[model samples]
Target: MYLTKAKDYLLLCKTIFSFLAGNSSNLISQREMERFMYLICLIFLSDADTTEDVTVVYGIEGKPISINCSYNLKENQWREKSWCKHISETKCQHVVSARRFWMPFLKRRNGTTAIADNIYEGILTVTINPLKKKDAGLYQCKTDFLGVVNTLQKVKVNVLTDLWETEAPEEPRVEQSISSTPSDTETKLHIIVAGLLGFKFLIAVLILIIARSLKNRTTEDGYRRENEHQLFPVTGNGYYS
Candidate 1:
């Protein structure tokens, strides 16, 4: 029974490591990762104001995790409110920053760490989706600017419940019309509908212009005919002089 449990835990860790490897592009920026770790620590310690007790000291779990946050003036305002409320204030960018900090920690399981070459180098997005109970741990995120390293954020994730579920990605659902027509018929129908609509509009415009021109031409022709009849005098009402 103990061996089975141990094997399960190992499998979970492997799953997390594979996930990180697939998204190596996201792990490139160390600064963003550092900030994300700090954010997770804050989430874990939401119940306690300070880390005076052993529970808080040990953190929610034994593992040490890191996250990264990028510096952006527009997002800083939002981060302040998010720090307390855990709700964003029109700073989606800051929310994204926080997520970057959370990803690595959430991806971790047990005490195993997944490290890669240049995991924290430049701009990257670290994300932890569908957070699990195992994700709760000691988290840190740091960044180096101009060769000066600064710890931008630190946080610990603590999960009290046995079941941990992260947010699911929303997928766009498309309903295709049920029709199994030949390719030629489908193409013809599409082209015909488009052509008819375009031709109808063009015809309407042309008719209006042509009607106005014809009316003007008719009026001019009538005036010219009347002038000719007046100039040529009729002798005694159709009797020859």
Candidate 2:
């Protein structure tokens, strides 16, 4: 519920992961480096339904879940906007069971849910006060697109029973990846920096070798000229006829 009210944990982690990659891309000197960074990013992103374009969210079982989502339901997509309760940080837990569709109007089964919340009567009083607040704007624009005259009423309903758990128990992979990313990124950065420094050192050594070779050649030529001058000297004291 906290995660739902604030921000999705999985999405927040993915945002940070992408931000790191986008900003740090300038330092990537190799294909292997970019691949490795994206692989780390995938660890944070792949667990969700990106392949199928499905979004996983979180909320409570009843009392209008505090969330309204547009997604495919029952494989038929009869209901595009699913009234979901985000029980877990990243998983939509309960789904309302509506056997009928395209009715002129819907009956409130458990406040926000038109149907599906049933069987549990114990939580009724506990949820009565917030029920109005939760289901306030649900049907505000119902007539806007449904092409039908419908109005969201403030008629109070019973508390919702913990209905069908739509999503399976998924391991929190995002938590694992987020907790360990800092150390992994730092270590990889160190390795890349060291490789870059070693390359610079190699270039410096080549330049020194070339400079020394040129200096030695100039010194040898000067020595040879001095030896030639000493070996064949013209006698200043003797005159040539």
Candidate 3:
């Protein structure tokens, strides 16, 4: 009972508000109402991620343009309390959905850079460079209310030419080359020669040391044996005398 009455009251309020939005010559003063209007535009753009369908037809070289929008619902079709509370972060879905279109809009201007005053008076405006090829796409303005939804209008942007597009080069063709260059072969040969020389030098030194050691051992053994024989005279019976 209470829920039904509250729904009735909201529907009445929306109808009255829609009239004011369209017919009232005075600008809305209340911050809440203005915010509500902003939310209405957001709902329309909830599905738009970019400004591709929305075109900036007029603007000064540096000044930004604005895109404004409004929407309404039927009295019988009003939903109960499903507005801002259900939406996250000041109704981010609308902004999130609008991103795809917004990206090209920025790139057309300066690529991922935020433009000042891109939104105004229910109208979203942006500055464009008109020279970027990626700027060319479709744009649309949409409006909706609880029960009534509308795709209000759209604009198309066309880029005549861009430096990026014009200056692009053809893909290169690289052929694998095989070569036995003199410098590289010479380096390898020199390394091999040096290694062989080092090995020969090491072998020569080892051989000399081993031979000298064996010769000294042999000479010492011979002298020791001779000294033994001299100290003890060997008789014919094999006894030392």
Candidate 4:
């Protein structure tokens, strides 16, 4: 639809061109010349793609992100530029009003929004700091020429609440070699250590009990043995003594 209108506008321009060329003897008025020039400028600025060239920009909530808008560096560097929230092709709410005179290299910041135009690079960068969910929507980079605003770029901003919502790069897989069973040698060593410890503990206990029993028997026997003259003491098993 736009292409057809552009073609018709171009045909009109050609007709105007023919009129100027054919009527060389008849001088054109200053107002007529200005109108012709305005029409040509309008046609040049209004040329657009069939579908809007909208670049999708993803930003994390509470983080700063910048959107770049490129334009004809030769002609548009000195023109008034704006950063706006786009409602429709012709209608937009200006986020930051158009700067009448944009200094080529300086960055201008207004609250949370910033605009930096680099004429040498032919890129206008709009930075939004600590973005909110409400800031997510369609936006435009606009340039004003002779009272007509031309959109230099269209951007769709998406502010994500979670970092995980963004697509993450895939990690490489690692291959590990592992065996679940224990080695025979290790099992045998453990068993041997356990057995030695148990054996030693049992032998020490037995020796301690025997020494205690002998000491007790000797003390009970020496002075209280029956007849008091035997190499071996006899303990009275049947009586209370």
Q: Judged by TM-score, which candidate is best?
A: 4
What is the lDDT, from 0 to 100, of the residue 49 in candidate 3?
A: 28
Tens digits of lDDT, candidate 1, 1-241: 2323323543454454445545655423333333344445344344343343212222223334333334443333122111111123322112222223434322322224332112234322233433455555444444434555434344444433211211224556669855575564566577789889999999999999999999999999999989978888679779434
lDDT of 4 by residue, 43-141 (tens): 353443224678766666888888889999888878888798967766788887434454555777777888887777778889999888988888999
Q: Which candidate has the top score in lDDT?
A: 4
For the record, the alpha-carbon RMSD of candidate 3 to the native fold, in angstroms, is 27.9
Over all chains combined, what TM-score does candidate 3 have? 0.25
Q: In model 2, which runs have C-alpha deviations exceeding 4 angstroms? A: 1-182, 234-241
lDDT of 2 by residue, 1-241 (tens): 3453122644564455456556665445333344454345334443432233233222233433332222222332342222334344444333343333454124344543454211121011112223443432212111112643322121212222222122225555555354544565686789799989999999999999999999999999999988987787757876322
Candidate 2 residue pairs in clash (backbone atoms < 3 Å): 58-86, 59-85, 59-86, 59-87
List candidate 3 stretches off by more than 4 Å: 1-182
Model 3: how far residue 62 lies from native, Å: 42
lDDT of each: 0.41, 0.40, 0.42, 0.70
Which model, 2 or 4, shows the larger TM-score?
Answer: 4
Question: lDDT by residue for model 3 over 1-241, one digit each (tens)?
Answer: 2323323534554555566556644333233343455345334333332355443332122323333322233421221111101133223122111222233223222342222212222233333433344434444444334556445445443332222223346656658955565564476577789889999999999999999999999999999999998999989999877
| Best first by TM-score, ranked | 4, 2, 3, 1
Ranking by lDDT: 4, 3, 1, 2
The C-alpha TM-scores of every prediction are 0.24, 0.30, 0.25, 0.44
